[model samples]
Target: MIKQKRRYFSFLFVLPLLVVFLLAGCQLQDQFNAAMSRLAATQSVAGPTLEATKAATSEATVIATAAQTATAVANSTLVLWVPPQFDPNGETLTGKLFNQRLQQFEASFPEYTVEVRLKSENGRGGLLDSLSNASLAAPATLPSLVLLQYRDLESASLKGLIVPLDEDTLNVIGQNWLPYAGQLSEIQHNLFGVPFAGDALALVYRPAQTPYPPSTWQELSTQNLPILFPAADPDTLVVINIYQTAGGSLTDENGEPHLDTDPLLKTFSYFSNGAQSGAFPIWDTQLADFSSSWSLYQQQSSGYAIVWASQYLQGQLPGNELTSLPEINGQKITYAQGWLWAIPQGSSQSLEGARHLLDYLSEPEFVDQIDQLAGYLPVYQSGLDAQTNPDLKATLSELMNSAQPLPAGSTINSISPIMESSTLQIIKQQIDYIQAANAAANQFK
Candidate 1:
């Protein structure tokens, strides 16, 4: 009886300890559950970061690599790189047409398989950047042909990334291409690209705002009305155009950028008159590029807007009418820029194919339809006549004849800053026309 009582007391003592251990275990489990819940909530709240983007890109690369399989390489493959605006597989009508054209080219030429890649129009990973990088590190992967702006064409030629066209290629190009178009690709008298799509400045105005648009700088300055342009553009296209309109030469015989005080004074005299007269308002000076001025004009829609023919046409906004630039000394003139087809230095074996493609693209029928749809001008004389609208045809023809190619990239790069500073000083009335002229000219010396 005594032993049984002792054993029962021992069981009661152990039962209390077991209950304490069970309570501690429950508390620890609850804490762990709370921590796990908090962790999930934090994860949900956090959005994708730069690190996530890089991780995703890496995963995609891994997947792509894993998917690759050994296969027989095609013979006579040609690779082409173009800006996004010219993407062949995009949803726009222009893209559809371009894609169809590529397919057509491939169908007609069975031996050649064309590969198209889209690149940004400017900046890092753009045409020039990729071209430069590939030229140094991945030469074998260099494109057979590339579409580049005239400025880039010059830079590419200077870098020796793009090769100059032979005499035979130049001769063929000269036969059909417009003079200014040919000039777009001419670097140091060597043809580095084949010009295809042309863009030029045009005057846009609302008929309701003004009965007749100003037809000359004389009229434009004296009218004392608002006119919008990128006066502060880093490119200093305004300065270049006005100086050229005053019969100034942008380059000397040696192909170096040159400036003369006479033309500079004449150009600034107009800015002086306009700024003082309010024809070119102080608010207009705030515009740093064509886009800002164009956007401002859209909201107000009361005055004249000077923009690229491409920008205006692509906009297709109602009530605004497009017209030729004003007459300067009985001549209709403006600055023109273009896109060109260029063969890379590594693409020697594909020269024949590249030239063939260039010739095919420059055909009047194709150029007419494509340029018209894409708000671009054809670089061929024949393409000019192909426009169905007689008035547009006439206007484009005049522009084609009178418009000059923008100054070479190197020339503009060297001269723009000096001229821009002086032009701003003149517009702001911080200096006289003579002072501005002298200031601009002295920089070149």
Candidate 2:
């Protein structure tokens, strides 16, 4: 009975303690809710510090976005380096076309800017040497875009200085560019450039003097009239014109040098024979010194001359009918040559702006401009179709259809100087050697 009574009292004491604990827990919960409500009210009021923090975060985001946009805009400005072929006069077709179009491009694309700069080394200075120096110091005053010769593509590409353009960019330009331009873009399937300019061998003749250009070497040899080949030292240009007409290949598939010695020898033999026969003219020393290559044909003393198509077209003809050179075995061909525009290998602006420039140059309308100004045949069908002048259009159509591109590789570059030198020398040597051989033959016979 005593134990039961003590147990009951203990239970009563513990129940009071449990109730107190419950009350304390409830009170703590109420205090936490009240504190949360106070915080909500404070946030609703939006104190200056809180508002400032939010505004600062938003402003920072805007600043970050603006910085990113500015960086992109800066990147869109292309730094282009063009070869020094253009004189300051901007008189020639090449100069007029490039400079005028560049101005138009700038005005059209306000979002993009093109900075035309001069290349330290180009043409005469040597492309490979310039490219090497530029690669070592890329992205620092380096050209993001460059206008390079088509012939130098092999060397530049092999050195890892240039990047292959994306297929989209290539298709946009390549599908409609000139045929030779498209050919120059690839070297064993690797693309390196876009066609920008071209000049081909043409026969400028005066119909008033010779009525018709000879169809064979015999006619040229038989005619007593003086004929000029310009650049008395330009034997290589003449030789290549002859060699290509004869379907000669200077390089093989593996990039091996393959000059057909027999063709050169045969060509030299012809020159020797022709000079003795009084078929070759000795009056002119060089092609350009004679008031342009076409000046040879324009000369009243001359009947026909082989010259650059662009120069001839740009020249003022004096009622003289221009036609392709006389045919050999009905082949009826001439030496076709031109240049491509390429970005430097290590150019930083090569990504987007450079691509845009290339595309602009390669577009059909731009190609038409080049054709009209330079007298270069447009490689793209659309450009030719757009031509309005009947005579020019007809001539360009014939040239484009008949033109065959020069072989592109290091072999062409390697042997170009040799061909130039050898041809010039051979022409000079032929005169003396042929006369001596002729005299010696008579004595022996």
Candidate 3:
């Protein structure tokens, strides 16, 4: 394994000397980009394995083209675009923390100025849209770096809106981020982004009512406790999480998107049982998103609810406590997605400065602060250590460790409706779980 991993490195490297040496002339550009494939292989060396970049493109090449502007420009301004939740001027503690970090970046590298801009998370003038616009209309206006959702990163990379990261960054990320995080930072076999903040599904419950969160469906039924979750979410994320936890595989023998009927039956049967026990109310069908379900749980102080780690952590909602998802048997499971920092595909003049800022933001201290203050799961193992509280730290470690990257949109689209329909039917007592599971599986077959 070690021998195979060494193939990612073209040669041993030293940072300061390499940057200066590479910048000396255009003649060394080819040598500077000795191995573009290493840009993504860092994850493989770190562990669970990953694919190498298929194209012969690397940040060195990108930076090489604009090396003169980057070094000779004297004072350079690096622009960063973020969503409203990350607005530096906002009152949120996480926002304030970011503002402080940006200030620190400028102080550390006085030769560079970091400019902040706000963009919506989606839709008109959003990060993706604005990236597309700026890349076409005014290449110079493109922000040096942008924050993207894992799914959006896939889109941005596919459309050539974002560029691959350098090998050094991926090496650190592979060693720092949790396994799922490495997966999140990677898309289409390439390292295109660095995970800054991440989120995962977890259980939120009223501590006064239940001393310990139940770890199995049988316990919930035996205790006659109902857990509130959005059975109506179009994505069927809750069901998927539960299904996978019950030892089901989301892919078939063919390595394609699939539904395992036995596990589906087991999960749906829980819903059917819950409906009779009043663990799930008729109104659950009306809840289509986390907000509505979370609000309902708060109003009723209901037994349990499935919620995003961020929603429970960031909102600081009263009267509830967070824990890992209800484990099925001995295993706990959840799906995760997160924000990433990506360089927009444009002039590389700001690349050097942007990388500096990216490095600073990815520091363990900074990541720890965000995990505690911003309601995000720590992306790094060290960041997890920053939790401070032993109990919360232990719980988060287990849940985050259990997390897997949320599947692609196409996979979600294929399986969600079937899961949602079967789940709702069981909750509404419309059909036997066995029949429903069989019917759903037949569609995929």
Task: For residues 1-445, write the lDDT of model 3, one tens digit per residue.
Answer: 6545554453444355467657888776676566434543653464433223322245566778688677655449788899888888899888899899999888888888888999999999999898899888989888878999888898899899988998774334565778878889888678998888888988888778887867787677546666778989999898888788888877788768888878888888888778888887777887899887877777774577778888887776666778887777788778989999998888555677778888887787787787678778888888887778787789788888888888777788888988998888888988888899899888988
> Which 10-residue window in model 2 sums to the lowest lDDT?
436-445
TM-scores for candidates 1 onward, in order: 0.79, 0.70, 0.78
Ranking 2 against 3 by lDDT, winner: 3
Residue range 1-445, candidate 1, lDDT tens digits: 5444544665575566556656888766666567556645544444444458789999999877665522112436778899988888999888898889888888887667788998898899999999999999988878888999878888899999998888665445676777778778688888788776899888888878776888787788767668888888999886688788878877878878899778788788888898888878887768899888888888884778788888887877877777877776776668988888888987534667777766676566676677778889788877776778786788777777777777777778898888778777777888898888887887776
Q: What TM-score does model 2 achieve against the real structure?
A: 0.70
Off by over 4 Å in 3: 1-75, 136-138, 169-172, 221-223, 317-319, 347-349
Better of 1 and 3 by TM-score: 1
When superposed on Cα atoms, how far off is each prediction in RMSD? 19.4, 10.5, 22.3
List the candidate numbers ranked by lDDT, top first: 3, 1, 2
lDDT of 2 by residue, 3-27 (tens): 4454466556555555665678876
RMSD of 2: 10.5
* Best by the lDDT measure: 3
Candidate 2 off by > 4 Å: 1-68, 83-111, 118-132, 176-178, 230-235, 247-262, 283-301, 408-445
Q: Residue 195 CA error for candidate 2 (Å)?
A: 2.1
